[model samples]
Target: MPPAIREGSLVFPKVPVLQAAGPLGLCQMVETSILNILGYATLVATNAARHRLAAGWKKKLFEFGARRAQGPDGALTASRYAYLGGFDGTSNVQAAYRHEIPLAGTMAHAFVSSFASFESLKPATSLLGPSFPNAVLAARDSVFKLWHEKNFSQMAKEGELAAFTAYAMTFPDGFLALVDTYNTLSSGIPNFLAVALALFQEGHTPQGIRIDSGDLAYLSREARQQFKECEEAFNFPFSALHIVVSNDLNEAAISALNDEGHEADVFGIGTNVVTCQSQPALGMVYKLVELEGKPCMKLSEDVEKTSLPTAKAAYRLYNKAGIPAIDLIQSASMPPPVCGRQLFCKDLYDDKKRCFFIPKAVEELLVLLIKDGKLLQPLESIEVCRRRCITQLQHFRADHLRLHCPTEYKPTAYATAEVFPHCRHFPEWRKRENCAKQTRKCVHQTLTRNRGEEITYTSQATTNALPFKRIEGSAVACCCRSGETCEPPATRIPTTSERCAGNQTQKPGLAVPHRAMCAACECGQCMPHSRISSVRRGISKNAGTPYPRVRACRSECRNSATMTIGSLIRHAHRRR
Candidate 1:
């Protein structure tokens, strides 16, 4: 069964995010592997979501964590899940291509710093000076001279510009400069602008500047101020330039930057995005909730560690305002919530706590993703999952979405009479008070009735006890015919010769079960009551009338030779 869908629904810990159902051991082998995969995937996705939320709706968040990821495969997993958690794009090319996610990246710092000096451009340096004069060749000599004159930091800045000029020559259409090699504000930005202005004048628009070091919040503000000043002075569109920040940024750091008034347009998240540094594992668990038709439970000293025992379904209850108000959990076999009916909810751990809501809308969150070991639906697209994350966030109130001190969301058990009967704990709550009263009354009656009896209690009392010794003797023996004495006129075991002769005289169709013979009769035809109890094991209740009626024996014996085939078979076995 597919569960209802609801946006901004808090379903985890309220109900299982994934459920497996089958016979007692049908899915036993796959539980651990399933939980591990789900646990890691959920953790990364949640981490990505926090970053997206922290970045705000307008700003873009990109996954640049391939190299920092656990492995190449892990990198792919991160990129896919990050997109689902609302990231705009990813740096992993394979992930982008496979998942249809937008691919994003530009020149790295090493790419920009690769060029040393323009003089090293060879014998063609002077020949090409006029053609690329202002952007590359014109400043090469002066920049190299400063590099030889000033500190190593200044030399590094010159190299950055030298490389940027080369890259501009290569790809003039998109010119995003990495401006933090030596110093973001000092030499990097200045050299970048000098080359960028030359590009702008030549009818090319510079894309943006990237900051890879320093206090990102402070650097972004400084870079934006410079860009604004240049736009006014140089009379070009500098304001349109994007300020990309790609330091050690995580969700918390992003939120902090936002709070402190950063001017960043895009965030390139790496280690923290893919690794989920703060909470690396989701700790998801797969437990056996049911065995065949019976409910199963695992006890733990920590109540939170305990698992809910039985098949279950989950629901989302919306308030009158159409905002999700509570998550309701129910037995899978229980009837679903009906429209216009008041649905009662109980706390998962607390029996006394209860609440009721007449929902404006009801939604089930689980769908039959798999059926009988086969997938029931195609996997949702990355775009669809990403949009779903955003849509779900929008349905919740702002208080719950806060990055710090967020409002907590909890799930409640569905507890109407029908729902309650299905819940083992809910019904017990109703019976507790009555049970206590009845127990007290019974205790009082027991004490009152036994008040005068001299009672002795001992550990060995049961072991030393006798079976009705005070009243026991022998049950009075009754005659099978006259109800007088059980003693017969002659009591003697028949010899083998006589036994064989008796067997020979039995009815032809008789074939007795080996152990069903009676112990009380030597004549081969005794009442069923005279047979040992084990003789009746093979006898079905409908196995015809018990010991079919027999004609009176010649000597009025308890066992007669003219008994029915069943009786004769049972009797021959007795003689054997």
Candidate 2:
């Protein structure tokens, strides 16, 4: 699947995203660990991508959540994945060291408050060791020249200026001061500029300043305006200085800043990105879908909880504009869908809803990542993954990626009735079991009378009592009881009630109700009892049916060959 695939996009459900076809014990042992790792990694990466989208493509985004993360390990993971999701850098030093991610940060309030006055800068030394005193005098003279104010010492807080001066002496080329330690407009900006101008005189360029409190948008604008004033007055490049913002910022906050028209060049995000406060958990589960070469299914009264059966393949269908239109899942054995050929697609849970379209291009989503317990290729670098994510997002339609009233990207997961006709009836049979108490009895009686060839009847209340329809006009004969007539295949189904009545058994000169007679015709049941039992056993084991109907069928039925009781009882559990 594409890295930027949005939420609600069906990511090949019923198909294995990571298949472990090995010894059963080995597969079972690794399930929990794999789920745990993939779940959180995917969650943080997606959250970071959303933040990137909200912050826009041009702005720099840094991960500043190490202290706020769950633990040291979580902080490392968040930093790595956040960078992979398009963040520019991280404040976590260990993450930057380990992953080679660019490091970004600024001074704290403690650093500013620790400085008392000009005397506090006495211990600070610059790169110009012997000429440090002369450099400081030159820097102060340059600041005075820029502002043309002789009383520059009284213009801002002495401690703040001392702090900025000390930091500049330490990292003159990479100094990014935290300006909100005292007063943003009144003292912080002015003190930062005085030290920045001093750094300029010492032949080193200052990086930027950060605002950690107050109205960020307004403060950034005012700070930028102040920098521009100094740039015009002194004929320096002060207007180009960066304006970084921090203090519990999030995606919405960045967007709001954009809306309010601010000069913020970088965002230092922390708790929200690392902790995933908007959605704390990613609901990814590990389930066995195939074992011993047989398909497995988990049925649930809640349709969404029902697992898809079999090993399958997923294909993303793109329209002519190179935008993805639909994601289609099919059994692994089926050939890949071809472009320019009309294909039928059905909704995962809805039987009545369907569509047909010819794709301009089709991309097989599943790839062989590992073979013979060895990786097929080297893992992608964080930068490569980041680029892939950003590029993939751009291919999607704008409306589908929007935050509000976004159009849903349609996905289809269908078990073609042509290949698995019995599977097509599973949903209908499950619904029948829920709607009628007598469905099990009906199935038992039909199985007994028909000798397990096929089901001969179904309740009219559970299904539409339409006349029997053929599967794509195929010549295959329907399974019927002895002396019962089988209608010839028809291209169009006859809707007349007489056709359903004629297919049913009736007494001479006796009147029979239309619905009751319609129930007697074996319209859609063609798969043998053995095939149905295979499907039933797979579903019954995991579906959590409340009743003992399955156990009863196993004990009571003398002819094990003619079992049909498992069909209706497979999904008898209540909705969860």
Candidate 3:
């Protein structure tokens, strides 16, 4: 996995988190632990931050993912990370208690449904409604009539109303209702309003309403409109009520809600928050940069996968506008950047692409988290981390943090020629480049040398021990014993002309005789088949497209089991 940069810092395609010079074994041993710790935490935190950003800054964002998390430990981890990523609170009680995060959520659908069988008071049977005749009873009857029009089960609606009444009686001050168990508009809202109005008469303020299912934005708006009318008609205290929406909300859904103009006062986000539904892993990794005081780098065909080969100090250089102009990584031995001097930093891959900045502020990014194997810095509070996250996000440019097609913010190395003159990465990079050139040169020479001749360089040993059959027209290096041939099994199938002419001369549809085919060497060179007992196909020079394929000799001629024409060419090129 790739390393994770600090939050709100300019993120690019590939960015290193930390670089150090230390013993190889010491650094390598802790790689797995480093990856495990940062991977999920960073992903969850980033996801939570995105959701917070999508939901307006003023709106309440609650993390309710504990129930859906892997386990109790996972729940706590998710809750802590979510809190640090700008979540207002978490529904996980243990997380709240442990992390000192604010706790929220009063009840679920089960709590409301528990009172479904309770008896309710009607206008005719009870003095409660008729006692207030023209004022309360009139408004209640009107609202009930409107709601009852679309409601099919009067009994079910009554049950819901009874449930609301039971909840209000239990916790009169905390009267928020989950209003989507049945029909939200027809049954839930009306029943909730009835109980809410009663609480208001007793000089109690109804907390709010929650819509768990349905079009949340539309439902919230409708519910709010109804509450406003009820406030005016019944002269009840409903104006300050909060409308909460919770239905598997993630960043995209929250963004859509904001765009469509939702009336919801709070969002209870769950699955996507803890699990990081969109991107589950952060791909954070710890790699060895330098060992034994000497710069070291991992060699790979993929440059992005390779790590920088030195102990480096990273700094954020702020421009005149107080925005980060560039993130500069320099050799640890170099002096910290000064404000007045011009800072020249170049892209690590493309040396020509450089940026010069006269920084107003030069702030070092890395500090001693641990010293002498003991932690130097104290663990930060969730609130402190959350505030820091927000502060960092404010510094990040809007263009760099867009939901789609974010602009890349590539970090540059300061004075690469001077600082990294003896760095291991450059030499390794040049070595690979040279190896490629040599491979190509040897391949060209072999193809030219063996052309027009029925090359038969076969080894005397293992002549009868070859497992795979040498099919005359086979494009692939290896084949089944049946002598039947087709395209290579891999994605690298050679075209018709290339397949026919790859090893030996095949006149159109005519198969070249087995003895006439080119024999591959122990070192993977293409020669006459007479010197080699058996041969297998080598790596294709042009992957997926048939080109210079050097079959490796099956007999013990060189180091390995077999060699390829490509390998032979590489060997030849290296010798020269």
lDDT of 1 at 200: 76
**lDDT (0-100) at residue 465 of candidate 2?**
22
* Candidate 2 residue-pair clash tally: 0
Candidate 3 yields a Cα-based lDDT of: 0.62
lDDT of 2: 0.65
Per-model clash counts, in order, read 9, 0, 21
lDDT of 3 by residue, 1-576 (tens): 112244433344435564433455766777787678767777788887888778867899889898899788889999988888888888899999998999877567776666644354333433333443233334456566644655534634666766776666666778788889878887788877777877777677778988899999899999888888777877776767999899899888888898898899999999889888988767665666666567767767876677676677788888888887788777777788999788666677764466566899987776656555665657666676788788877787888767778787787776444345422122112121112211211111112222553322222122221222232443124221222222332222233223222443233342222332233321332333433222223323322322333333334334443344345555333432
Better of 2 and 3 by TM-score: 2
Candidate 2 per-residue C-alpha lDDT over 1-576 given as tens digits, one digit per residue, 9 for 90 to 100: 111223222243343456667777988999889888777777788888788888888899999999999899999999998887878999999999998899988888998999898677675455846455445556555555655553554556878877887787788799999988878876788778877876776677899999999999999998898899888877779998999998898877887888889999999999999999778897776666677778787767887787766667788999998988888877777788899988777777665556677899997777766666776667777777777777767778878766557786656764554333223332222111122232222121122111122222332211222123233342222222221224343323223332232212223342221121122223333233454445444545642332122221222332222223333333222211
Error of 1 at 138 (Å): 6.7
Query: Per-prediction TM-score, please?
Result: 0.68, 0.72, 0.66
- List candidate 1 segments past 4 Å from native: 1-10, 120-156, 415-439, 442-576
Instruction: Write the number of the candidate with greater TM-score, choosing between 1 and 3.
Output: 1
What is the total number of backbone clashes in candidate 1? 9
lDDT of each: 0.62, 0.65, 0.62
Which of the two, 2 or 3, has more lDDT? 2
